[model samples]
Target: MSALPRHVSPARLPEVRWLRSSYSTGANNCVETARPSAGPWAGLVAVRDSKDPAGPALLFSPASWTRFADRIDRL
Candidate 1:
């Protein structure tokens, strides 16, 4: 198995649609996520700071992202 690159420039992503949790207040304090359906990132989940839409993004496999989120939710 190969690991996905830790980060990618959002600018390199083609047509990414970033989404934040509805639970997020409007303060830009939460992370945003997007699932890339094409390009090198196809099928990977991308995470970035809501306050910096143009910043670098961290890529995670769907399962890993889900696990991370579930753990955070339990806290």
Candidate 2:
């Protein structure tokens, strides 16, 4: 995996509607994700901590997203 930019503050990032996985139980240790609704960031998926909304987010390409989901399903 590649490292994320260290200087970026998640709080300063654009507001996004983070959604938790439906499979997640009541635990707060779940991931939240959001995709840009419009503009240049559109189609880019942003993932971050559900427990820390202001935490750093990891950006993934569409293909990478699919591969990630597949890997998760196997776990």
Candidate topping lDDT: 1
Task: Report per-prediction Cα RMSD to one decimal.
Answer: 0.9, 3.6
lDDT of 2 at 21: 94
- Could you tell me the TM-score of candidate 2? 0.75
Candidates in order, TM-scores: namely: 0.93, 0.75
In candidate 2, list every pair of residues with a backbone clash: none
Task: Point to the candidate with the largest TM-score.
Answer: 1
lDDT (tens digit, per residue) of candidate 2 on 1-75:
444343334654566688899988887789888886665455777788788777687777778788999998899
- Given candidate 2, what's the lDDT at residue 31? 88
Measured on C-alpha atoms, candidate 2 has an lDDT of: 0.72
The list of candidate 2 runs beyond 4 A from truth reads 1-8
**lDDT, candidate 1, at 57:** 95
